[model samples]
Target: MKVIADENLALTDYFFADLAEIDYRAGRGIQAEDLTAANALLVRSVTKVTPALLEGSAVEFVGSATIGTDHIDLAGLATNHVEVTHAPGCNAQAVAEYVVTAILTLQPERVQAGTDFCLGIVGLGNVGSRLAQLAQRLGWRVIGTDPNVQLPEIENLSFAQLLAESDAISIHVPLTHTGQHATYHLFNTQTFEQMKPACLLINSARGEVVSEQALLNDIAKTQRPVVLDVFEHEPIISRNLLDHLALATPHIAGYSLEGKARGTQMVYQAFCQHFKREASKQFESQLADMPVLFNLKQPLSTQLLPLLPQLYNIRADDQALRAGLNKDGMVDAAHFDYLRKTYPLRREWAAYGDQSF
Candidate 1:
């Protein structure tokens, strides 16, 4: 068997080499011609897999080693008789930590423990729900909005209510273009105007969830601090947006080593199941010595601001993105991809559990 896979999928060969010969390719540049001899395909979000993309190819199974499916045309792939599966919640911890780190960086004043600061979560899926749990545990009043999902503990608010009431809003919805609650450009001018004054805005979800021009205008008008890990025109993002953002990253919010390894493990199991082969139950990256930078003897709420930075200095990510883009003021796709590809994978908070304080 032959497999076409994304070079970025961690442990792609370690897991699949025994099963098939792998043809690794850059995700964004993967094309139909590469699938001619492939029995299975593995991808990250950058590659768009439609039935059209699979036409005349002998590919059967396709797996995305990421949580979201917006980039994949599910119905189309199924209609073409292709077995499709994705690793949902694989990077939930990574993304949740990213949001928490951003919040502490942007508005640490609002997140003191046992506090009543309102945090509005716009989705209740894997990533959003995990974020809500983290924020609530940190003593923030967490409210969520997802018409199709209801977390009994989290007060369900309408999208409008979330906008009007939240002290800081973190977007986690998928980029949908249809349905009653289509999220495409969901945070446009009208919605932005409805938001609480000086409310922090975060979009680690998808770029199209907020209209770029509308966001640019809103930033100018309200001077609201914003954190964006994803951009509408990603890779070719707006430098103006970069200038105004409180924190910006090259869509590496979910790029943790553990997360990537989990995603790869999930897809490998799925591949084994589909092909009727036995799968290994134990999987994950080996551990390293994770040192706690500060004494955690104090109340965590009082020190989250400083503690999280020591664990993962989010500003370093912001500066790196800005440094590359600020050089020529031109859209550099290669540089953007380079940042993600060469990103030194950060370990989640779980890794620090065994650390000697």
Candidate 2:
């Protein structure tokens, strides 16, 4: 058996040599010619697995180590009899942590006073649900908007109601067709116009789910501020939006160490199931520890941002990408892979303890 693994995937070395002859390369610029003899191809979000890349290849199976599959050509893979799997909900906690931190940073005064504020979770999936729990724990009113979910007790509301009532909105929906009220450009001009002017928008979901130009226009037209962790064109963000937005990060909102390790173990389990092999004992035991929150007598208002990076350094990723602008496409691919494989230690909010400082 032969397998080609994207270099960006976490813990590639641990799983690569176990099953088959492995060919590892950076995800971008990977052509079909490279996998002509491969039975399986593993990748992250950076690689686009289209028909053009698989038509002439001997590849039969595809695996992605991330949640979003917008970059994968699912229809083409199915037509070609190529099986594919993705690690869904693998980074839910990481994204939830980011949302909580952003809420604290954006509205420190409200958080300090424990004043109630509306948090509209646009999608009540894994990440959104986790975030709602955190918001509720912090004494915030949580309103969810997911047309797909049919729960009797959870307060489900219309998208317009969420927009008008929420003081802050966080998106966590997938990008799909419109039949199920798909999330592609879900927050466009009309939706933005309907939002409260004082609203703070956070997009950790797919980029196209929120229109870039429309967000920019809305920010210019109103007091609505945004904190974007995903952009319409990744690795190439809009300059105008960056300058105006309160927070702009590379797509690392869910790239915490715990998240990446969970993704790695999930794929490993999937691979084990495929071969009918007993899952590794170490794999089951290697779960990352949750964050610890330090209880303070007084709310640490001034120490929030400075202390946050200790748990998850948001700015380090920003600076790292900014430093690598001059690299070629292949170099860019290598850099991205390096960042993921050598990802820094990221802990959840609960990981910080009294001794954290």
Candidate 3:
């Protein structure tokens, strides 16, 4: 079998090289012509997988290495008899840790997080649920809202209640436009008004889930700390927003080394299972020792402040993105894509010594 896959997918060759002939290409430019001779296609969030792309192709299966499927037309692919599989919750640990780090880093140093510090989570699925677990472990009361699920990490609350009660909030919902819990622009003027005046807001999930205009307006009024990893128009982010944000990253929240490896492995296993073949590659072999620079047993204030920055100075990502966007004589989109394509890989907290973090 010959499989056309995204060049960004980690371990694509390591996992599939022996099993099938591989054709790796940039995700954004992958076109219908590329799949004409392929038996399968593999993708990431940047690739749009629709029936039109599959119509005249020989591809019978499509695998997405990332957690989100917003770029794929699932129903259309299914209708066309093309099997599809995605790695869900693969980057949950990475994203969860990112939320924790971002929250503590963005909040005032005077504010010590103890039992009373409440973290409101919107959409308690993979990433949100993981964040809830981390918050409870780190001694933050977590209140969540997810209208779709009957049971969540904690008893679910109304979206308004979560906004009003949470000292800081993190968003982890999918972007939907028509459902009852349609998250497109979910954090608009009305919802933003419900939030605590000074509540910290973080969005590592989809960009459109929060209305950029409404957020810009609300933050202008309340002067709240907002850490954004994703933007509405990804490659074309706002210079104005960058100036005001506590931290801004180019959607690298889930780019941890372990996360990418796990995602690639998950989809590889699924592909092998579907084809009734044995999958020999294991992702753990790709993991290495995480450098522990600070004592975890030390006080959270001093230890974490030094430790998180050593492991991941999120501000560096902000600076890098800003520099890339403002480069002389280059398009913002090109710079943005180049930054992501060449992002320095980071390992998640799980990769640190087996001791409790």
Candidate 4:
């Protein structure tokens, strides 16, 4: 079998040689002509798989090493008899850690003793649920809103209630088309108007799920801060929005080294299952190691913002990207690709050594 992998995917020679005949290219400029002879295509979020891109190709299987499949045209692939698979919840902890860090960073004042605060998790899926658990462990009152999950322990609340009552609200819902009860610009003008002026808003999930205009307007109206890891147009992030936000990242919330390894392993396992190959045993050993959270000798106080950044300095990555792009002009697609391809080594909390404080 011949396989073509997106350059951003970090599969080594050992991995590709073990699986199939592989051709890897870094640029996401994969034209149909490029894949005319390949049977399997491995891609990340950068490549858009559509009929126009693969109409005359011999590709049979496509796998995306990322949580969101918004970049993949699933229906079109189905119509063309090409099977597509994506790694869902592969970076749950990575995103959860980022959200937690953002919360701590934005609300340092709330770290004092005997201060009770509520964390509003907009969606209670893999990432949201994990985030809720972590928030509870950190002594925050956790409330979740997901019409799909009817758990007795997770207090289900209306979207409006979450916005109005939460001290910090973190969005984890997927972006869907209109008419869906779950989400589609769910955090628009009305919802933002209801939110507490002191509340800090976070969006690690899809960007368009929260209306950009509404978010800007809301930020203008309140002193409450907003932290964004994802944006509406992606690589073409809104300069106005970035300048206004307290913390802004280039949708790398789930791009930890550990997360990428997990995503690759997940897809590899699925491929082995589909082909009934003995590749499972080899794939098991290839599982990437997650970053260890250095154990603190003594339990630190609730003021974790400073400590957390030292442990996982997300801002450094953000600043580096901004600097590389000059932060003063439109970054071309090639520049964006370079930024992602040469991304910094962001490991999960579990990958660090013993903690100092």
The candidate that wins on lDDT is 1
What's model 4's lDDT at 285?
61
Could you give candidate 2's per-residue lDDT for residues 23-129 as a string of tens digits?
A: 88878767888988988888888889988898778887788889878889999889998878888888898898788777766666656444368888998877888
Clashes of each: 0, 5, 0, 10
Task: Give the C-alpha miss distance for residue 53 in model 2, angstroms.
Answer: 1.6
Q: Give the alpha carbon lDDT tens digit for every residue of 167-245 in model 4.
A: 8899887777855575778888888888888788899898888888888888887856888877776667645766678
TM-score of each: 0.94, 0.86, 0.93, 0.88
Query: By lDDT, is 3 or 4 better?
Result: 3
TM-score of 1: 0.94
Compare candidates 1 and 2 on TM-score and give the better one. 1
Position 133, candidate 4: lDDT: 68
State the lDDT of candidate 3 residue by residue for 13-66, as single tens digits. 788999999998888889999999998999888899999998799998899988
List of clashing residue pairs for candidate 4: 291-350, 291-351, 291-352, 292-350, 292-351, 292-352, 293-349, 294-353, 294-355, 295-355
The residue pairs that clash in candidate 2, if any, are 291-350, 291-351, 292-350, 292-351, 292-352
| Runs off by more than 4 Å, candidate 4 | 12-14, 26-28, 111-115, 281-306, 324-328, 353-357
Question: What's the C-alpha lDDT at position 241 in model 1?
Answer: 80
TM-score-best of 1 and 3: 1
- What is the C-alpha local distance difference test score of each model? 0.85, 0.74, 0.83, 0.74
lDDT of 1 by residue, 278-336 (tens): 99744453446676543446544665675675568899998888877645674488888
Q: In terms of TM-score, which candidate is strongest? A: 1
